[model samples]
Target chain A: MTKPTGPSRRTFLKTTAAATLAAPTIVSPSIFAKGDTPAPSDRVVVGSIGVGDLGRRHHLNNKLLVNPRIQVAAVCDVDRNHRDLAANDVLTKSGKMPGVYKDFRDLCDRKDIDAVFVVTPDHWHALVSIYAMETGKDVYCEKPLTLNIEEGKKMVEVARRYGAVFQTGSQQRSEGPFRQAVELIRNGKIGKVQRVDTYIGNIDAGKWQAPITPPPELDWNFWLGPAPYADYFPNRCHYQFRWFSDYSGGKMTDWGAHHNDITQWALEKDQSGPVKVRCEQAQFAPDGPHDVALEFDIAYTYADGVELHCHSQGKNGIKFTGTDGWVFVSRSQKEFDAHDKALLTWQAGDNDVNLPRTETKHPHHDNFLDCIASRQRPICDVEIGHRSATVCHLGNIAIRLGRELQWDPAKEEFVGDDQANQLVGKPMRAPWHL
Target chain B: MATVTELAGDLCSGDQVKTYQAQQALARLSGEIGASGKEAEKAEAAKALAAVLAGVKPAKDNRGEATVDSIKSVNSANELCRALSLLAGEAEVAVLAECLKNIDLRETARWCLARMTCQGAADALVEAYKTATGTEYRVGLINALGRKQGSNVLETLKLAAADKEPEVALAAVEALANTPDAALDAVISSVESGSSSRRAARVARARVRLGSTLLRAGDDAGAKKVFTAVAGADVDEAPKKAAAAAVGG
Candidate 1:
C-alpha cells in the first residue's frame, strides 16, 4: 500500500473550486418537490452501517438527516427492527425511504453512495471502514477507531492508500471547551506540562447469564461477524456489547476514547504515543460472559517525561497539570477551570499556537462533511484516532497481562515482550480479514 | 507467596478472587521463566501447565447434567491454556493439539497455537484442519493457520478454498488473502468464473490484497496487472472501485 502523502494544495484548491460551484443550498420545502432527488453534484449521498443507538439517535436524526447538503441514501444493520426503525425515520424526514440492508456489504456495493457512516461495534469498525474506503468512499467511523492495535494500524494504512477522507467520531475534539483547553496548553498557559489525569468511568462485571434464543428480528451470526462465536445472551448485544473483551475494551475504549483523546491532543502527541505503559491496579469481572477489566488505574510515560494517568474513579474529565498551573476540562461541565482563573480567559495571540475550532452546532459532523468537500483531513483524522485509541488499548493490554510493557511507538510493538506482542493483534474469526 | 502447586489448585477453586489471583501468579511465573533465558526452564513450565490441563475432566451437560464441579473443571482448563499460551513453544504443541479435539477447549487451544510463532504450530493447525469435522471448527483451524501464515499452509488453504461448504470455502478464501505465497492465479480464475456474486467478491478482494503485497514489495508492474484485471472483472462494484482507485492513483 502506498504511504499516505496528505492532500496537496493543488488537490485541495481543485476540490474547493468544484464544491463552491456545486454546493447545495438550504432550499425551502415548497421549492423542491417532496420526493425529488437532489442533483448528484450538489449533495453528498450517505449510507449508514449499524443503525443502533448512536447510529440512529445521534448520527442520523441529529446530524446526517438534518444536514441539507447531505442525503441519507441507505441504512444497514443486522437487527431487522433497528433497520426498519431507521428506514422509517429517514422516510418521515426526507419523504423517501432509504434502502435497508441486513448486511453492510450490500450497502457498500452501492456506487451511488458517496460516503459511509460506520457506527458498528468496535470489532467491526476496522473491516467495515476498510471495505468502505476500498470502495472509494469517505468514512465517518465512531471511536475508538479499532478493537486492537493492529487494526488501527491497518485502518490508517488503508485510509491513506485509498486517499479516503476519514473521520473518527471523537466529537469532543470539536467541542468548545476541549479546543479551548488544548489551545491554552499548547500556547504555554500551563507552562511546561508535567502530567495529565483522565477520569473515565469503570465497566461493571457482567453477570453470568445462560444462553437463550436470540430475537427473531436479529441476525445473530451477522451481528457477531468478525468476533468469535458465542451463545446468544441479551446482554451480549446492542449497547451492552462494550462490556465484553471480544467486542470492546469496556469503558477503557468507550469513554476513554473521548477523554484520553483530548489528553493526546493537549500533549500534541497525535501521531505518536507513550513509550511505557503500566497498570498500577486492575480488577476483572468473575468468570462469566463479560471478561473486560471492571476497574483499572494505568500510568503512561512519554519520551519527554510527561506522565499520563487514567483512572476509573475520578471526575469524568481530563486535568492537565503543568509547572505553571493546572487546567481541567469536561463536556459534563461545558466550561473549563484553571488554577489561575485568568488563564481560562486567555486568548490566542497572532504568534501563539491556535488549534482548529468547530463553530457549528453539530461541529464534528460538519467538520467531516467540510473536509469531504475540500479533500482535506478532518479534525480527528484516522491517524489521530488510531494513536489515541492505541493509548487506551495499551492500558488494556497491561491490565490483561498484569505487568509493565515497554512500547516502541514508532514500530507499534512491545519491546522484547513476545506475550505482549501477541495481544497486539487478534486473529479474526474466519471470513474476516483486515 | 503461593507455590506453583497451590496456585494451580486455586485456579480451579471456582472462586473469582482466587482464580484471578492464581492466573496472575501463573502469568508472572511464566514471564519469569521466559526472562530467565533458560530453554530448559521454559519447557519445564510448559510441561507443568500441560499436566494440569490434562487432569481437567471434560465438562458434561447432556440433558442438563452439568454440575458446578464440571463448570469449575472447564474454567480451570481454559485458564491453564491461557497461561500456557504466554510461553509455550514447540515442546508443548502436541498437548495443545490434543486440547483442540475438546470442544470446550478448542478456541483457547487454537489461540495458544496461533501465537506460538513456530513451524510446529502451523503444522499442528494443518493436521487439525485435515480431519476437523464441523464447519465452524474447520473454519477456526483455518483462521489459526492464516494468522500463523507460511508457505506450509498454502496448499491446505488452496484446497480448502474449493471446499463444498460455502462457509468453509469463504473462510479459506479470506485466509488465503493473508498468505504471502497464495496462488493468486487460482484466485483470479475464481474471480472470473465464480457463479456466485459473494464468491466473486471474495476472490476479487483476495486479488486486491495480493496486489497490495506485490506493490509493497516493489513489484509495481505486477501489482498494476492484478489491479487492472480485478477492475475489469465482473465482480461486485466494491472491489472494482477499489481496484480502479489503486490503478488510477
Candidate 2:
C-alpha cells in the first residue's frame, strides 16, 4: 500500500492529472483551471458563521481555492468586528458583498447557501454543524473536531440523515510530511509499530492569566454557547479559548487533534478510539486555573492492538516507534534529527482517498465546495472528525477521572462504570439544540 | 476491550478468584429472576470465559522468538510488553530482554528502554545485536551501543570505529555523534566516507552536532508556504506577509 517517495508534493500528481483528463464530462482539471472554473451547472453558494480565531484563518481564504466559481453569499459571527472584517475580506476577494448576520441561525436559514463553514469554538461546532446540515448545507468545521465524544456522535448521525458533506479541519492530513509519516508507519517503515510517542503539550497554566474582561459589542453569552459561563478571562477567550475546558480540552484536544489525527488516520482507527485511557500525570503550578489535564503522561490503547502514548511536553509533534526504526516529525525548525531534508512529492490516492470527478489539491475546502455542488462527502469527513475527536476526549476523561478508564468504542461508554460512563457526553447549556 | 483479571501481578489467586466467583454468583442470582437478567447473565458468562481463558505464557528460558495470539494474539503481545514494562529491579532487565525477542518492534522497544533507563536504551542495542548477526552487524551494534550511556559502550565503540573495514568504522564513528565531545574527532573523519549515504548522514549528523540546522527557528523560510502550512491553507484569509520578515534572521 505504501509507494516509494521521490515524487513531488502532489506525489500522485501526474496520476490525478491524467485522471482529470479522462474524467472530463464530470468536474475535471480543465474545468478547475483558474480562469476556466466550470460553474456547478448551478452555482455552489456558502455562508459562514462565527468568524473568530478559527473562522478567519480556516474558512475566509477560498479565493486561492481551485474552484473559482463558488460564491461566498453570506457571512455571520456574533462579534461585529469579526463580521465586518470577514464580510470585507470576502468582498475584496470574490468581488461581491455578502449578506452579514449577527445571529448564526439566521445565516443558516438562507436557502441560497448550500454549505457553511462552522469556525466557532469547540462547544458551538456541534450545534452549528447539525443545524446547517438539517437546513441543507454541508459543513466544514475546525478541528479538535467536537466538544466531546457525545456531541461528535450526534453530529455524525445528523450529517448522515441530512446527507451533508461535513469536513473536519484536520488539514495536516493533507500535508506531505504528515502523509509520509503515516505512509511509512502503515507500510511498516518503522516496523510493526507498537507504541507511538506523541508529544502534544499544555496551555501551561499561566498562559491564561489575562485580565477578565469581555468587550461590550461581543455577545459573550452566545460566544460561550453550549459551555458554562465562566469568569471572563481575556486569555481564555477568542483564539486562546482552547486553554479553557468549557470550550476546549486544553492541549489534549488542541494540538492533540492535529497529532492524534495522523495516528488515527494511519493506524486506520479514526472511526473508533482506544478502549483504554490512562493518564499518568503531574499537577501544574496553580493547576486549578485551567480545567483539563495540566501536565500528564497518558496512554491510549486502541482495539486494533496499537497503543498511543500522548505525552505532555508543552511542545507539539509525534514520534512513532516501531520494531524497526523511528521517525520524529514536528512543525518546529529546531529539532534533534534536524537534517532529514527529504523533499515531499505529492501522490494521489487513487484507490484509497477516492477523489471525486473534480480535480483539486484543495481537498479540505474543496470537499465542502464540491459537496455543495455534487451533494457528496468530504475527505476529512465528519465521521472521521468525530472519531478523531473521541480520541482526544478519551484523554480528557482519563485526566478528569484521575485514573485509568476502560472505554468500549462499540458502545461509546466506560465499561460497567456508571460514574465514568456519565462523563462521555457533557451537559449542554439550556436552549441550544443540535 | 478484552478483560484481563488485574494483570498487575498484584491479584492474589485465591482472593481474586473467590471475589470474581462471588460477583458471578450475584449475576447468576439476578438472572434467575428475569429474562432481561438472562442477557446480562450470558454476557457475564462470556466475559468470565474470556477472562479465565485469556492469557498465554511464553516458553521459559528459550528466548527464541514466538508470535502470540489473543484468543491470545496482539492483546497478548500488548499485555506482555505493558506488564513487562511495569516490572522493576533485577527482573525488569531480564523481562526487557524477553521483550527484545520481538526484534521487529524497535520504536516501542526504544521507548520501553527509555522508560526502563537500563543504561539509556540498552534494550535497543541488544535487540539490534541479537537480530543483526555476524561481523556486518558488529558496527551497527556498536553504533546502537553508543546510543546508550556508561563506559561499557565507549571501549567497544572506539574499537569498532577503528575497524579494518572503513564503512564499518564509519558507522561506528557516526554512532559516536550521539555521544558527546569525547567522540567528536572520530565522527568527523566519516564526513568523507567510502559510502555516499553513510557520508551524507555523517555530514548531516556533524552539522546537527555543530548545532547547524538548515534554517533558524522562526526564520520562516518559504514564508508563504510556512505561514500557509502553519496558519490555514484550507480556510484563513489574512496573509501575514509579516511572516516573511520573521525569516532568514
Please give the CA lDDT of all the candidate structures: 0.80, 0.57
Write model 1 residue lDDT over B1-249, tens digit each, in one string: 886667777887766657766876776577566653566887777887777777777667562576655556657776777777767888888888887787677766886787677788899999888888888778877777777666668878877877877767776766776544434646534623346666666677677777677787777887788789888977667667777888998
What's the TM-score of each model vs. the native?
Answer: 0.84, 0.56
Clashing pairs in 1: none
Local accuracy of candidate 2 as per-residue lDDT tens digits, A1-434: 12334543223433554455444223444234455554343345777787765676555674322246566788888888999898888888778899999888778766567677788888788888876765557788888778888788878865654456688888776555676667666655567777777888765654435344678868787787655444466766777777666688888888888888888877877677788888777454342345455677889887767789988884468877777667676764244221123312323454334223334566455545544444445557888888888888888766655667889887788886543554566544323423
Name the 10 consecutive residues with the lowest summed lDDT in model 2 chain A. Answer: A336-345
> In order, what DockQ does each candidate have?
0.29, 0.01
User: How many steric clashes between backbone atoms does each model show?
Assistant: 0, 27
* Local lDDT at A20 for model 1: 70
Per-residue accuracy of model 2 over B1-249 as CA lDDT, tens digit each: 123244322221323233333333322232232133244443443333223322334334334444332112333333233323322223344444444454333323333343333453564455445454345335535544644666656656666666665655655665554454422443444344554433443333332322211122232232323333323222111111212222322
Q: In model 2, which runs have C-alpha deviations exceeding 4 angstroms?
A: A1-35, A40-42, A62-67, A207-213, A285-288, A331-361, B1-249
Q: Which candidate number maximizes DockQ?
A: 1
The CAPRI quality class of candidate 1 comes to acceptable
